[model samples]
Target: MKKRLKLNLQSRLQIKTVPSIRLANFIELPEKEFSRFIEAVENNPLFLKLANPLTPEERVIIPQKFPGTRFSPHCFLSLDEARLADASPINLSPVLERHHKAIKLIRKLGLDKFQKYFIERTSAVLPEDIARILRLKKSQVEAINELMNEVSIHSEFYARSSLGTGHKISYIKVAKIEFDKDKNPGITFFSPRHFIGRYKIDYEKVEQLKKRDFFLSEDIGKLNALFGKLELINRRKNILYQTILGIIEKQKIFFVSGNKDDMVCCLQKEIAHKLSVHPSLVCRAIYGKSLELPRGEEKPIKDFFLPKKEYIKRVILTLFKEHKKVLSDNQTAVELKKTFGISASRRAVSNYRRELNFPSSRKK
Candidate 1:
């Protein structure tokens, strides 16, 4: 009878679990409010910070504090207690430490001026030369340059907050370019947890709360809410990444046809349909995000999702350049189908050509 009661309680708790708030709404929040929200989440009592440093792969664990049957109201373990409980403390990555130091040095030396100097220079500038100009040590310059190169390739997302007259910027690694064994480029995404670390659940404390008849349901519901948001964000990001990869693979011919103007058409609705998600979710995932290409160009995530008509126009222009001679609408339409496997009516081709302001066959 006791075991049956316990099972019934567990089922009730599972059934009463509340859903998490929408990640889209959280992302679409204003900058100041968003920062505050992040601060609140990070400062929650359930999340205990680690005094000891953490390795890249290590996560902090919330230790059990009260061992006896009697449970204190303050059941959660303190930071000191957690540290003491941990037998093996992991050290932070040296590379990550150096990167942080470099960012600080750059901020102190004036980021605006440094960027201006680089932009004004016509030729490639060396780190030593930059250091000489900025009155910084060669090593410092080299470290700063290394961090800058990483940002240019991996693209860190910076959140800014007002600090008196000046502003303070904190960076988080969002996405990075990864290569396969074949040397083909792909994308790897990192969640906020990757940069800010997370605390493991204290199951002992949870069990105690339940035994004490404390309102564990409310706390569980809150946690479930957070989990829901994180899960949704991760799912949407994965779908978006896979959709982009699929587009690149299917449109290889468009990419390699020596047409610099031609770009992959990745509409949000189309991607959502292919991935079985809402278009609004895709928009939220892409909002305020930038991706860095292998060639060091940083473009907004939305730029990848060009309108279908724009892509078609670029292809038509490419076709015109390839032919090297004036072609009538009928001829252009035929060539598009034969060469690029794109079928368009002659009348539609004529409309697109006029829209591009290209001269007619007679005018040429």
Candidate 2:
């Protein structure tokens, strides 16, 4: 009962896609296309016969399936005569072909290819694991890393609910810190703006295309796929933002002084819970993603994972410096739990102390 219809025509054409800003589903074709397609069917006898319009008061004749029976051609016009009275130019061959090709190419390839294409275009890799997955030659990866070194986007200072309304709100001033040509560090903040691609498309322009007389029928379905893909990319970018903001909000002291020592332990699960997403999603978002910090540097999101051994070392060092006597590793473990909330086994504490040449007990 359904088959492809072949039509040959020549006309200037362009494609427009309408997608919801908040949702990643559905694409709708403009009304003008429907009107034009109706006109095209009227002008072509073959298509008109296939459409099979029925007349009022005309008795329906069911066609016989017996061989050698011939039936009169039939045509249908769902739209009223008044609606089709307005003549519209309908040409869809070119537009349908283009949309079909693009959709076909997208479906034929996997996400990895597209990810690599974007990475190549944006040069936006930061995590070592992502680099390994990219499988780029060592030279190519290093070359891209060193090629373009400049601040691309800028952001403004702002404040939010401090991650919890109960907690005091905090102001954020992101600055690009770079040393002057003479080697003196200078701080600069860029104009505040939403990150690019968040809401770049103008729906009004797409609406304007509705006034046209015709569009490709395939465009609706094809563009839906295209827009869905675009929305996914936007989602990834959003995840990166959420990840960074959550980290900065939780570990305020580290970013304040720009010192690793100030970094408190931040777990991936903690961030995932705060963002209300899966821990695996948080991991995927941070994989190969880096945020351009106010310090005019790019840092991997994974760097927020406080190194356990290093943290233990710092905690032990603090305990040793503040105490008058060397405490047993067991005592050190207990003190670590009490003071820094770090749970460390006695053997682990002893090994770290011995590795650092700190005696098991303080010099009496």
Query: Which candidate leads in lDDT?
Result: 1
Location of the lowest summed lDDT over 10 successive residues in candidate 1: 67-76
Candidate 1 clashes between residue pairs 3 or more apart in a chain or in different chains? none
Q: Per-model C-alpha lDDT, please?
A: 0.47, 0.41
Please write out the lDDT profile of model 1 over residues 56-107, one tens digit for every residue.
Answer: 1222232221111111111111112232233312322333455776756655
**Candidate 2 per-residue C-alpha lDDT over 1-364 given as tens digits, one digit per residue, 9 for 90 to 100:** 1121111111001011212233122111121232232234223432222122232112111111111111110101111223223331233233324344332332343444433432222223333333465664544444332211111110111111122223242222222233344433322322111122122223343344334422245543444444344344344434444555566555566655677667776788876565444566667555543334445444556767776787788778778878966789989999999988889999999898987788757554
Show the lowest summed lDDT stretch of 10 residues, model 2.
7-16
**lDDT (C-alpha) at residue 40 in model 2:** 40
Task: Give lDDT for model 1.
Answer: 0.47
Tell me, by TM-score, which candidate is best.
1
Q: Which stretches of candidate 2 lie over 4 Å from their true place?
A: 1-194, 200-216, 273-299, 355-357, 362-364
Reference-based lDDT, residue 205, model 1? 50
Candidate 1 error regions (>4 Å): 1-23, 30-39, 47-181, 188-223, 229-259
Instruction: Give the Cα error of residue 244 in candidate 1, in Å.
Output: 5.8
